[model samples]
Target: MKIAVIDAQGAGLGQTIIKKIRKEIEKDIYIIALGTNTFATSNMVKAGANVGISGERAISSFCRTNKIDGIIGPIGVMCSGSINGEITPLISKSIFNMECTKYILPLQKHGIYIPGTRNLQIKDIIEEIVFDIKNNLVLIS
Candidate 1:
């Protein structure tokens, strides 16, 4: 299975997600790291993503042409004017319009909050996400 982990800025969240996913899921899977900048992409790559890409145009173009089975990222990825405006309208539109499941971390920024969510640590949230992916998604390997 192929999963795209999108992030911006520092990409610490994306790196953590990749590491946990690798540790938890024994099955062979391809993780693609999509970042809004070089720092983010390189960080994710160092964390063991199979491949990494950066920039708004690259992200938009890849999402348009590639077959991404799933997408995981902060809620900012889907919100235009998010991540300090790093996520463009095209990127948001492409991600939202893609025919793939999205596992979004309910991170509140820029006055956006995911209602009813507890103030869980990043590790706890990632564990839940990894568990959900393992239980809910079918992997072909």
Candidate 2:
């Protein structure tokens, strides 16, 4: 299966997800990195993603076509329209409106507040993602 790891300007989270996927799933799978920019995409690619797509245009196009089996990242990746720097409305709408499956972390959920996240390790995020995805696979079958 193909999985898209979507992320904000920081690719660390996407990399964490890739690491988790590698350790958990033995089957052949494709990791598509959809970054908010080139830096984020490159980081994820270095981590493990087979392919990386960056830039606002690329993100919107990818989402529009629904080319990925699933996505993982922060909801802020979908926030747009002058709300924050580089958060365009088109990309935001595409991400939020898209119907693709996601392996969103608990702290990344919409309207969910996570306190004192300064020291949260990447491994912790990976573990949660792995657990969630494994559960999802079982439930779907």
Cα lDDT tens digits for candidate 2, 1-141? 678888766777778788778778745677889887888889999888899999889988988886666788765665564224556777777877777676555453445556766466657866766776677666655
lDDT, residue 112, model 1 = 80
TM-score of each: 0.92, 0.75
Which residue pairs clash in candidate 1? Answer: none
Each model's lDDT? 0.88, 0.73
Give the local distance difference test score of model 2: 0.73
Q: What's model 2's lDDT at 138?
A: 67
Q: What does the lDDT read for residue 84 in candidate 1? A: 89
Top candidate on lDDT is: 1
Q: Give each model's clash number.
A: 0, 0
